[model samples]
Target: MSIKSVPLPDIGNFKDLPVIEVLVAAGDTVEAEQSLITLESDKATMEIPAPFAGTIQKVLLKVGDTVNVGDLIVEMSTQDNEATQKPAESAPAPAAAPTPPPVVDAPARSTTAEPASPPIPPTPPSTAAPVNAPTLGASAHASPSVRAFARTLGVDLSQIAGSGPKGRIQKSDVTAFVKQALTAPAHSAPATGGSIPPLPTIDFSQFGAIETIPLSRIQKRSGKHLSTCWLNIPHVTQFDETDITELEAFRQSLKARADKMGVKLTPLVFILKAVARALADFPRFNAALDASGENLILKKYIHIGVAVDTPNGLVVPVVQNVDQKGIFALAADLAALSARARDGKLTPEDMSGGCFSISSLGGIGGTQFTPIVNGPEVAILGVSRSKMSPVWNGSAFEPRLMLPLALSYDHRVIDGAEGARFITALSRSLADLRELIV
Candidate 1:
């Protein structure tokens, strides 16, 4: 038998992942593709698997040790095919044929092209078997991606109820869990104040009969997410009103063309285009804070999410590649996505990957309102009812269509000055269509 070393596989851009668990000990027999150790990063957890079957000669890593791709994991004593063949020399030539099958079967079982590699198990020995954490008391039924996401947030998967296939945990499940944790009310008192007493639970039944209607699933989920955004993010709302008098006239001019294209182009479409341009001018608004909270992830592609109000709750369907698509294309996408959202037909994919969000209450009656910043996204635009207001044009005062704009952004990522600049740029785009065209 000969000894062979197993090194960690490529984990992609992640450096210095800390070892969370060691599955095998020295002298323990392990099979090929079996998990040997688990590494956890800020965003996800991953496992190092055995390359080939062998008895572990030396376990090079332990829990809490930091590791990276290509780092040595274990020294394993594997069967030497040449040494095994030495015994075949004394036997008949026919024995050599059977010996080749074991060697062939060994490689075939361990290294199949399909499932090309082993599942990168992302838990330590205490939670061995990524699919089933027997040691953890109850199994967390979740997809690999969901598992990694849960670990990234340091959530206990066993505590969350799955709302997916066969009760499998989904990405939304992990997100919901984190949001709940962030928003869940604190039972403790304030650090500066004395212990505050809890509010008394009222029993209204003593006076009159009351009926309880539970909130819809969507409402409950959204409420938690909104609460998280409100408490965790330091939001600064930059309020400004844009003069859309000329822009509205231009949009009306295209009414016939828009109708011929089988789409109704509304003011929101023009606003979408303006937001995309502003994002291009200010790339920080198009970025998100990484899981570590130390790095910024600036997205090159611009996808905007439009908040739609449904009977069930609020849903944000994303319009992809806003920077690349024209107003007409955006009109079509918005029409399709909003209709689907209202009909409760919007899939999970329809609501993912939004660099920015817009919540417009213009159709209803609202002068101004604050909208929470969507998690993972740094900013959101709130649009309210437009009204005719007198504006001074340097020479005289004239009635102009003024649209209320509330720009809420993460104070950590954006400063008050940058916020002012973003809103100013957006206001300019609306005031002068030529600037947007240029």
Candidate 2:
């Protein structure tokens, strides 16, 4: 048997990645491609895999160690010539490091038997600063991912002691710090002039039995994003009902053809096509405010995001060039994206570059509800369940299928008049199929 050293592979441009977990120990036999260690970067969590089957002789790295490409991770005993040849062949290839999957709502696996450290005392909101700020101290023990997360919430890592092994900061520690800061006494120093006052905490368990359920990772991430958008954007929601009688009839006619083509044709596909047309007519609706917030960047391409409710949480997967696709094509893309979202197989790329978003509650059932504007994108369209209603067309009342729509936009980017016009145009496109072509 030959002892071989396993080094970190080429994992893109990332460096100084923190080893969050070591999956195997010395004397542990591992299979080829089995994960040996998990490294957390600013963007995602990655697991380094064993190049070839071998028995680990020694672990060179431990949790909290910062690693880079070619950094030695472990020393292992390989059985044959094939094991020796595998590293030489795989080390140079970029594919040696597989793409990290989307972060799921799961707890990190601990390597040691040490009890979890107690929660750190909450720091005053006024003292909160970026993790890299000098006030946080250079010796702060946190992975790049934790630093990035703290940066988002404007938390100083140095103030709060870490709860992870060896005093390394974890994401949960950051969250707990923020939660405590937000729930502090109302008289506490405010971070800004317009800072929100703290809400009173009550012990509900005194009156009734209660179960404390932790929010999933996806929920926590999305909640943070939504809170940011809500606080920063001046939101204006316009509620309207669109007559989809013709559209529904048209969809029913194509149901047979859609089934033959092996795609489920849904009203959402029609709504997508209509929204794409409306976006073309109203360029501002499809534009985003630049970082400076002084200029609007109009996208030449139309990529719309559809919010899919998965078992874990809600995810919005973007459909590229929505203005360029047909109804059947849109239906297929929606089906595939939704399926992947439910199965937790969606990648970051699948959920990026959205010019606008649509949240449809029609499948489940809701009369009307406002969807928060997914920032970076100026507007989001919310669709609710449709019902038959009586409407007068100049003289006699006729029964028509009406779909409720709530259009919420960033008031800083879109005015009241423009918001009305955009939703009106969208309603017209859905009312008549030919209007989409026009």
Candidate 3:
């Protein structure tokens, strides 16, 4: 019998699945029928099991992502099928270094350890493995992508040396390590010039009214990027209130049907659908201006960025081809992404390449606020909490579901007039509620 480790074919509805945890590491031995990872989508948690297990040698993806049916999940060699596979590594290194400290290979392994309030030096790999370190979860628990992510981040499950009952990796441990690694500087100590430990290149913080908090690597880079955006882009936030009574009614009508069909129907999902429909009529808003000082480069596709607020900070995860998905589908995807974002599970792919952004503070109590434009994108839409407000018809006033809208756009690409017009079109589309409903 020959075993060919293959990528898990992306098969199945991924609209609302949040990758819960990855169970295996690259190059780790896995048994047949073992679970690789666990996933929590819209309804329930599911696992991806190994059909023919041997050893995991590679991973192609990560957690905090949605997988459609037939997405490559893992590539492994079955124990009996080793002849067909590449030769194994001559000697397997001990799971952890002496002292047997938990391994830190990829940030993919699940751990529930909380972050140290004031950062301390991370334990070396030589520490003893905490017997109760982690739980040996099902094999299908982690997808190939998550395993790949851990590999990239250098997180090793074995080295983690389980601290949980039965040694299961928890979400907190993964979060803590990521927070620690990012905030800690990457550059090693500078070579001592002549003598002295490089004269202490990085100064330890001294006390003050403003306590110093070290920035994570991603945070530091993001700060520079945001500063650059602020410096260069001339941002103007235009606020408007839209009466979404009709839209809300329509949404309520379909939510039940969607749930029956096993799909989630969130408000942003409707908004995205509405926005996509409106963008076609208002092509000006859909297109991006030439940052090169030449002509406009209009993109045909709508890649909507869903602004997610995470413990780390605000991250915008892009939903590609938003124009192609329905409201229920969009909601499912957004829900999955949102959960991952809150859990600090999103990676670079999930946080980059957004053509336009939608920042919703509705979940948090707020009526209206200025949204910072995500640079390069010409515009960003902010959704405030929807509330009952008085509205005027041709002759009468009545209560309407009103949501305050804020659009922050780059003056270089969109003028004040064009921005207002775009808002008007969007508002009208939302009010009509027919374009997308049909």
Candidate 4:
């Protein structure tokens, strides 16, 4: 039998990461790559895996302890199968190998009933778990990837009953958990006597014959997300009009060239380019409120999401590095992504990491509508159909193509004045090709 010490591996650039949960205990057998403990960093929740198959002689770590690389986590006893065949009969266990004392072992420190960082209280399985769930010492049968997924959806593992082999939780379980949480009926508040009134649930069936059709999966998912963003964010929409008379002429001139390239150039594509340029000029509009809400995360690269109306529901597929691409390139990418989105072939990555989003209802004939700012991203641009209207250009009224633009932003990050300025910049970029190029 060989006594081996398992040490923590290097985990990114973070230091003094708090141990959120201790999975294994003394005298328990574990396999290589099995998670032994979980760590919570500022950016993400991570797990430390077992080094090798062995029986734990002593666990050196506990929840709430701050750990770093090279710190001993556990002491284990490993024995080869060949050695086990004759070990007990001939060598009588070989007098367990002498264990070396670790300089900073978890067990050596004084034990506390409470963890250094207290775990979040157990939310009723009815509600979604907090994004940062406390590391409860309770054992949860799940993989590291599944745990991460649960955290992303703000799910608590202890509350879910596993459906996999040996009752292991899977990604599907997390999805089902969220769906169940969202679809569940609203529970009445506890009788604490608060002044606020609750909306009375009226039985509409008594008034008339009605059919209840459940929301589509996309609608349900998007509804929960939108509700969260709307409730949490202080939103303000600024409406304006952009004169695209010259830009329209410029686009028409390139119609033949666009057809030659097998791409149908639409005003939306030009609008995408104009918006990308606007983001570059007004950098703050290309930012998101950090998770802490204390800092702004300004993105250097512009990836804009275009909302595509599908048979099922609306989906937004992101076009990456919009600033680097030309108008034609943007048109091609937009066409491909929008087609994929409509066909339901868009992948998860296709709709993620958008610095900003554009929801255009021009083809559908809407004058202007306020768009909800996609959470994390501070703002969204709404585009309506362009109409020819008389405009006074210095001397006389002349027919000009005018496009209505609505900018909805999180008021916490953007002031009303800044929102107006951003829309003004966008209008300028769309009004002239020179502004876009410059």
**TM-scores for all predictions:** 0.58, 0.72, 0.55, 0.59
Ranking by lDDT: 2, 1, 4, 3
- Stretches off by above 4 angstroms in model 4 are 1-199
- Tens digits of per-residue lDDT, candidate 2, 9-82, equal 77666556667788999999998888888765422346677889989999998886777788898998987675
In candidate 1, stretches whose alpha carbon ends up further than 4 angstroms from where it belongs are 1-200, 206-209
In candidate 3, clashing pairs total 74
Worst 10 residues of 2 by lDDT: 92-101
Q: Relative to the true structure, how large is the alpha-carbon lDDT of every model?
A: 0.70, 0.74, 0.59, 0.69
lDDT of 2: 0.74
lDDT of 1 by residue, 1-438 (tens): 898777777655555555767989998998766778866432223455676677999999876566666778888898886222111122111000000000000000111122222222222222112211211212456544455555555565666777876666666766666666555555443321112122455998999999989986456546645654665678999999999999999999999999999998989999999999999999999998876678999999999988888777677778999989888999999999878776655543566678999999999988999988987789999999999999998999999999999999999999999999999999999999788879
Q: Give the residue spans of candidate 3 off by over 4 A.
A: 1-80, 83-210, 216-218, 289-291, 344-349, 394-396, 435-438
> How many steric clashes between backbone atoms does each model show?
0, 0, 74, 1
For model 3, give the RMSD to the true fold.
15.2
> Stretches of candidate 2 above 4 Å error?
1-194
lDDT of 3 by residue, 241-281 (tens): 88888888877899789879787776788788777876666
Q: What RMSD, rounded to one decimal, does every model reach?
A: 18.3, 7.2, 15.2, 15.6
The TM-score between candidate 4 and the true structure equals: 0.59
